[model samples]
Target: MTNATQAQLSRTAEFIAGAKATVPLIIGAIPFGIIFGTLAEPSGLSTAGALAMSLFVFAGSSQFIALGLLSAGAALPVIIATTFVVNLRHMLYAANLVPKVRHLPQKWRALMAFGLTDETFAAVSNRYLLQENIQNAHWFYLGSFLAMYGNWVLCTALGVGLGELFPDMTEWGLDFAMSVTFIGMVIPHLKSKPMWGAVIVAGAMAIATVTMPHKLGLIVAAVCGIAVGLSLQLLLKAQAASEAQSR
Candidate 1:
């Protein structure tokens, strides 16, 4: 086969591999999507609106926040602010991936930016770390991104269709499963002091601000965690530089 043909095959394989590898992690999101679908209607969203959220907003945490605020009759600006705050972490994720993907054109970047989610990031980072020599890494990214996105949309539709059967789906406590999934994801990666510090600070702030109006504590805690983590990282880098110069 020609070298060009071989490269094309490699890209295709990587994309498929990425999608397949993330299938298990995507399972973790099923319950969350279902819970969102179940909660959406009772939270004052129509079935179409729920599907629209899954299609457009696409961020699980933000969608949940939107639902909660809507259920409680929050104003539009309040709902927008809370959801936006919950999704601020996406900016960090995007920034981290920029060095790897900056050479791509604007269209690819835009698609990638839209597809970057917590689950996809977990899948992509884990795969990229292991497959350092792989060609067309973004193909894998797209694979995982599409798989997770497809699962979310399908599961959401399922949840909405079945939502009527359970009038009090909120009482079912299914959303807790997502929390468990998140904790599982975080626990395995607390190997560094910076990570531990961020987790502790974020956790404490979250608890302390638990009763704040309109779930504003979620925003405050996120900002606190990012700030603490960033500050620690910078300090560590400076200290390392100073030690090197002294030597």
Candidate 2:
């Protein structure tokens, strides 16, 4: 085969490998996606609406917040703002990834941005950040992204269909199980002082604002946590620089 054809084949293989690697993580999210789907229609969204949200919006936390706000008859602007705030973390995720993906075409970056969930970030970090000498890393990211996107869409459709039969599935408290599972998945990644600080601050703020109206408290907590983490990181860096200068 020609060199170009061989390169193409290699990229395809890498993409498949990335998708396969993400299977476990995507499987973990099946329960969450189904629960979100089941809750969607009851939250005053149509089946089509739920599917569309999964397709376009695709952010689990923001989707839940939007559904809750919609159910509570929140104003459109408030719903938009709340969901935007909930998804603001993606900005940081993108910042960390930009240098790695800067060479890709705009189309690839755009689609990848849409797919950068916590799961994909974790998966890609292992590939690009934790390892050396990666080739066509974007293809791997694409594969993981497609796997997650497909899993969510298919699971949602199943949940909505089942929900039509069992209207009370929403009250079965399935979301709690998903929450526990999610926490387990995230705890292993808090391997640094900065991460621990962020988690503590965010958790505390979330608890303190649990009773806030329109779930605005989540936005407040997210901002507070980011602020605290950023400040702590800067302070530590300054201290290290001062010590180096003194030495």
Q: List RMSD in Å for every model shown.
A: 2.8, 2.8
Q: Candidates' TM-scores?
A: 0.85, 0.83
What does the lDDT come to for candidate 1?
A: 0.85
Please identify model 2 stretches exceeding 4 Å from their true place: 212-216, 223-247
| lDDT measured at residue 111 in model 2 versus the true structure, 0 to 100 | 94
Cα deviation of 64 in candidate 1 (Å)?
Answer: 2.2
Please list the residue runs of candidate 1 whose C-alpha ends up more than 4 Å from where it truly belongs after superposition: 127-135, 213-216, 230-247
Q: Residue 19's C-alpha lDDT in candidate 1?
A: 95
Tens-digit lDDT string for candidate 1 (169-219)? 767877777777778767867887777888899999999999997567876
Provide the lDDT at 212 for model 2. Answer: 91
| lDDT agreement with native, every candidate | 0.85, 0.85
TM-score between candidate 1 and the true structure: 0.85
Per-residue accuracy of model 2 over 1-247 as CA lDDT, tens digit each: 9999998998998799889878878878887888888888889999999999999989888899899899999998999988887777778778889988888889988999999997888778778887675668888999999998999888888889888888888778777756765676668768877778988998999999999965667767877887888888898899999999999
